[model samples]
Every structure is written in C-alpha cells, then in structure tokens.
Target: MADPLSVSANVAGLIGLANEVGKIPVNYASNVKSAHEDAHCLQKELTALCHVLEQMRSLLREEKLQGTRFEETAALVSVLGFTNHQVNELYKKLDKLSIQANKNKLADFWERIRWPLKKDECDKAMEEMRRLAQYFQFSLTAANRLDFLSQTK
Candidate 1:
C-alpha cells in the first residue's frame, strides 16, 4: 500500500492542477491554444487523481486507520470550487436511493417497475450526482457510520 502522506500529497497535487486549470485565461491571444491544451491535460489528471484518491481511501479503510481521509478529500474538492451545498444535496439524494434500494418492502415495488425504463429514470435522476454518491458510498462502506459521523468535525 502507498504511504498515506504520499496519497495526501498526490491529492494536493491534483488540487493544484485543478486550480491552475481554473486560472487559464479564456481570451488570451497568443497563449490560447497552449492554455486550452493544458486545461485538457489537467482535467485528465484530475480524473486520474480522483481514482487514486478512491484507492487510497480503500486502503485507509482496510488498515482500520482511526483517522479518515474522506472529509479531507471532500474539503479539497470543495475548496477547488465544488460547492458544498451541491455535494450535501447529492448525498441526501443518494441516502434516499440507498434506503430505497435496500428496503425489503420496496423489493416488490422495484420488481414491478419496468426494467430499462426504471433504470433510465433512476439514471436521469442521478445524472450529475454520481460523484458525491460514489464518494459517500466509499466512505460509508469503508468505515462504520458512527465512526464517519464522529469525524464530521
């Protein structure tokens, strides 16, 4: 497993890249092409960084680390201009979905729903919301809910 410090450093690097990408000028004359290219590259790097963060988070969970890195990652992402309100809202929706998905009584209701249609509906509802949902899923699955709740500070 990678060192936790190294993982944190990588996440910080990605956050820096995202900041750089945000600073690219939209109307620069001579440097427009290069700026666009750099922005694209940074976007790719950010995506990869998100994946790495997920892996590191999983490792942290498996090791039973008393401290969590999810909130730290979320804070970094939020600091990068991802709105906290949006993240919280998405999490609420996901909590509802998880409840709906796991409910025994809802099993019959889910079954009675049309297959692709229901899926498409759910997908549409979840569109632009998967990132937060996935983040929450990772955090919840890796650690106990009480542990996670206690770390909210």
Candidate 2:
C-alpha cells in the first residue's frame, strides 16, 4: 500500500503464494491424514483469497487517485497491509512442511510424513483469510459506490 505499483506487486505476490499452495504435496501418511485434508482446505481458502485480492487489485487500478475519499482509501490500505502480512505467515508455515518433506525424501523413502500445521492452526489461517477477503470486498464495493456517486455529481 506504499504505492500503487507496490500494492499491485504485493497482491501479485499473494496470488503467487496461493497458487503455490496448490503445489503442496498432499499424499501424506495415514497418521497425518487430517493435516493433509487441512492442506486441501487451506488451498481452497487461498484460491478464494486470490480471487478476492484480484478484485482488490482491480479496484486499486481503477481508482488510481483513490478519489477524494481519503479516509476510506487509507483504511483500505491498512487492511491490505494487514492481510498481506497474515497470508505471508500462512505461506511460510506451509512452506516449512513442504521443505521438510523434500529434505526427508532424500534421507529415507520410508520416513513418516508430518504436516507442520495442526487442524486448528489451518482453520485459524483460513478463517483469517475469509475475514480479510470479506473486508476487502466490502471496501471495494464502497469504493465503487463512491466512484459512481462522484461521476453522477
């Protein structure tokens, strides 16, 4: 949210992270099947988040000046920054599991696969993603309304 270009880049980075979530290996051991399921749920949530972030990016692009509604624009930026941080943390947590799995594969074929996140952790992350997306969606809708009102004026 520092600049329009940076905002777009941050959104793109988030989308990229969401896409990477899909690439996570899900063929986990039977003992950790729940975690594997959690990964799928997380992937789905991230996909939804990606769509929401894309809509946000479009809104930012359309309202380059952010118009005369300075307070709303500033609030949107704050939410965006917070959302970015949360998603990045989620990605890093998942990435740690993926990295460990890869390293273990080289050590032994029979090594037990373990997911880094518990069900509650994944659920928390997904909930946060949904909440952030909803906020962004609301902000985008409000911005669109403001834009229409200004044009009509």
Candidate 3:
C-alpha cells in the first residue's frame, strides 16, 4: 500500500461513510432528490474505496516489501477489502429498497419504530443495520490488531 497509515486513514473514512449511509432511510427514499442524494454519497464512498485499492496495489508493487512477508497486513487488508465489498452491496440494496418502498407506510412505521426497538419489521433496514454492525466489528478488530502489531515494532 502507499503506507499502512494511509490505508488505515482510507478505511476510517470508509467506515464513517458506511455508518452514515446505514442510518439513511434508503428504503424510504420516495423521491428523486433523496435517491439522487444517496447515490451521490455512495459515489463518494466508492471513490474512497478505490483509493484504498490503489494503495494496496502500490504495496504489491514493492519488491522489497513483498506482500507475502506481511502476513498481518495481508490479513487486515483482506478483511477490510471484504468489508468494503459488503458496504457497497448494502448501499445498492438500500437504494433499491428505498426506490421500491411505500413511503407513507415506511414513514409511519419508522416513527413508531423510533419509539420502540421494532427494527425487525423492516427487513431491508434490518439488513442495513446488520451490515453496519459488521463494519464496526471489522474496524474494531483491525484497530486493536493494528495497535498491538505496531507497538511490537
């Protein structure tokens, strides 16, 4: 990668974007403006992901820092890569669900859901939440591991 620090920064940005995207009521995007906005945000997140991929490719190009020797880095990159893919998939699903949602029903349900923990009623929303949680899980694991690994060096 460009550097471990750069990769970590990009991943942190990705996580923040994913967190925001997860909270958006994509399924309730009943208008062109909302969907368009969500799409724009997603595009920005994808651009960040692309930057991370480029950094990884740069790392691979380094003959002195051959990828095989950096086992922990490789593992972290792999997990982060998967998390990135999952984030994209979740975004697409959310947008599609939002477009297909009954906004009136969703609005009423969301209002009530806010008062209660009845998130299961909205399958798509639940899925987004689940993926968001997974992202956090991965981020924490990597953060802890990175900290420990860096300290040893």
Which is the leading candidate under lDDT? Answer: 2
lDDT for predicted candidate 3 compared with the true structure: 0.50
Q: Could you say which candidate leads in TM-score?
A: 2
- The lDDT values for all models are 0.41, 0.68, 0.50
The parts of candidate 2 lying over 4 Å away from their true place are 25-35, 63-73, 100-112
Tens digit of per-residue lDDT, candidate 1, span 24-120? 3222212333333333332343344345445544544455553534344454345323523433342343233223344576674443231222345
List, residue by residue over 1-153, the lDDT tens digit for candidate 2. Answer: 266656666677777866676455343433355456776777777777888889877765665554324343676667766876887787677665544444566543334456778778878988988888788788778878997999998
Ranking by lDDT: 2, 3, 1
TM-score of each: 0.27, 0.73, 0.38
Tens-place lDDT digits, model 3, residues 1-153: 344554555566565656555444432343333343443444444444444444444443445333333344565666666666766666654544333336597775544323222234244444544554455455556656875798999
What are the C-alpha RMSDs, in order, of all predicted structures? 17.9, 4.3, 10.0
Between prediction 1 and prediction 3, the one with superior lDDT is 3
Off by over 4 Å in 3: 26-73, 97-153
The stretch of ten residues in a row with the least summed lDDT in candidate 1 is 21-30
**Global lDDT for candidate 1?**
0.41
Candidate 2: residue 102 lDDT (0-100): 46
